[model samples]
Target: MKPSIITTLIIILFGLFTVQVNHRHLSRLRLIEVSLNKTAAGLGISRNSPTSMPKASYSSRSRQRHADPEVDIRQLANNLIEMVKMIPESESPKDRGELMNSLATLSEFSPSQIKSLLSEIHKSDGIDDELRKSVMGIVLILASDQNPRAGLDLVISSHDPNGSLMWEDAIINNALRSFANSDPAGALKWIEDNREVHPEVGQKENLEIALLGIAREQPGTAIQWLKNIDPSDRDDLAAKIAKNALSNEQRMAILEEINSSFVTSLDTTEMGKLKESVMAGLGASLDPDDFEGSTAWLENSDFSPEEISTITSGLALKNPCANTGEWISWMVSHLPDEALPNQVTKSFSTWTNNDYKTAGEWLESATDNAAKVPAISAYVSQIVFVKPQTAEKWALQLPEGPIRNSALKRIASVMESIYPGSEDAFKQRHGL
Candidate 1:
């Protein structure tokens, strides 16, 4: 088992040399394999070894060579430019059409990016009709985005007089909607600048919608626009929208317009509806002061008694006691006694029956304002029909005048009716 020391030493050196050689060989092999792999990958090889590097490289290179980088960019840019160029400056319909077609295919890019590209194109001059339409198409698509206002602004700013009327209508409508939910003042400014284009673009509806939106924020401005709208196109929808946009002053102005247009024309039905609307508006505001001018307007109209009654009812609802009193005073002072007897009687009946105590108090407080005397007398006479004793007490307090005499006669008549022998006796005692 114990061989010679030299033999053992030789064997150990050989073993050490063999181990070193093996380590160096393994290191070299790893280096070579790594180099081979890298070269293969650089040559486009699949590591799985199913395909050769050259073949894979050729296919990938071919695809890169064939790819179109600007296809999407051109399409988007063309679309935006086309829309902006709709302004007569762009002359080529064919180019615009092509751009439009290209834009229709651009669904991969972000709308904002597309909008940016379009904006760039819009600023460049000499873009033909074809490019303009393309640009417009892109703008149209973007008009549906959450921030379509940008597109709307571009459309409006373009001032494309020669553009398709249909496209103009769409732009105006989208702008109106955006304005309604956001910037009302901006929308009004747009309407003001483009008023002449409205009929040409069939944008009346758009204007109406926009005005309605602006009304909540700037009723005065909105109502002004509404007045300028053509009557030929007026409808319930327009009326409803206009009704909401008006301020007190603007509403009176609109009533003036309606009076000049329809009332003077003797359009009774239209005048009635207009009066009803104005009164309803006043009722909602509950401002008797606002109705003073309106009352005068109504007085000048050939309104039926029923229509006047309706207006008075509205006034009562607006400011119950206050408006009723003001309106009664106005009617008594301005209207001829004979001309409004029935109306006075009805109003008196309403006041006295609803609040006899208040009516009696107001009667006693009234000064020589003789117009109110007949009305007061009528009310007293009517009251005597129900409460003879109360009416008789009130009659005795009235000052000497037609009112007092009328109250006395009313009391005597009622007393005789209730107690058959009282009328003549009472008349004798009262020296009637």
Candidate 2:
């Protein structure tokens, strides 16, 4: 049953050839890894850590000559695509810097080259969703670099109207930002044109990205565009535009337009939101050091008592515990009876944390029991665990009300957990 000598020799040689082929294949893979690492280094990307590549503009590319023939765009793109295919599906490969560097390399390719690559990638069954989105993002950016309309069309066609994908918003926002930066009027026109066709494009946050970019360069045009949109959208968008204004003058200009434009009386809810937005914009614009100048702007406005209170709430939300003494004086003078308690509770809590002695002094000196009750409650809440006796003394000072009751109950709850029989005695002593 022994095989012929010639047959055995042939089998041995075949086995040796198989091992050599595998060695060559592994060597090719290692070479690719080394080449890519070198490419990443040249581009200032780290192969081991993820980094965002800046948007590639035509002017930026034009400055550099395409002198390296060995670094052919097509070849680099092919190698990166193959590397992307090797990444495990369950792993987040984008967390690796290689994919981002791959994108940087592919970004230099021509629109036609990008289109060809996209076609090939579309036909590729091995590419995962992460790689697919990364490639699409690069395509969208490059397409927008030349023509916003073309870029938007590619985005709309690739994405589903009803379903969301990872990086979908970022991809769209980046494209719109590039478009708006280059041509604000053109970007606005595109939105107006496509709002009906793609309702998703009309989302408020989406519009803000473009509007912010537009407002940066063209405030007048941005305002004119804002005036024509839905009443509901105008207030928030106007606020955002004002918030992002380049200078104080630009901020005031947008705010004045908002003040002048909504001449017709809006419903209660609309007016409230408008007031809040206006105050929020103003709050965002306030210079922390220029307290006098900042407060002067709001003081000069023709805001009603109710409107002032609402706007003050917005200001507190933006800048809480801002110069606690002066802040309390301003709030007491302006904030309505209904808005006072909640504002005091929140702001004083923050103030007590920063400087309890100063906070306690102010609370004791306050003439208004309305302010004192909530202020005491906030103060006690902060020190309840660390200084329970001080908390009890402060809590007992409050006049009979919901604020006083809540502070007592909080103290009792803490005591119950810390001292076994203390809850009942504390509750009975405080009249529950």
Model number with the top TM-score: 2
Give the TM-score comparing model 1 with the true structure, all chains together: 0.33
Candidate 2 on 1-432: residue-level lDDT in tens?
332222221222222222222242223223223333443455444443332222222223445343254444455556656655544331332332354344434434555555555655555566655555555544454444444556676667666454443345555665676667777667777777777877777777667767777888766557657766777788888777766666556756765665566546566677567757865665665653465765676677666667656545545555444466676667777778888888777778877877787787787787765677778888999978777888989888877878688889999998888898899999999888
Judged by lDDT against the true structure, how good is candidate 1? Answer: 0.51
Write candidate 1's Cα lDDT for 1-432 as tens digits.
Answer: 332222221222122222222232223223223433443455454345331111110122122232244555555465444443442433443433443333323333344555555556656666655445534543443343324455555555554556652234544565466655677667656666756664443356666666667667655455445455665544343355434633545545545555555556437776566556654443343345654665665667665555555445544443235345556676655555454555555656677777777776777766656446555666677688778877777676667876687689879988998999999998887778
Q: 339, model 2: CA deviation in Å?
A: 3.4
Top lDDT hit: 2
lDDT for each of the candidates? 0.51, 0.60
Segments in model 2 whose C-alpha atoms lie over 4 Å from true places:
1-103, 123-166, 178-186, 216-224, 227-235, 242-256, 264-269, 319-322, 353-358, 364-370, 400-403
TM-score of each: 0.33, 0.67
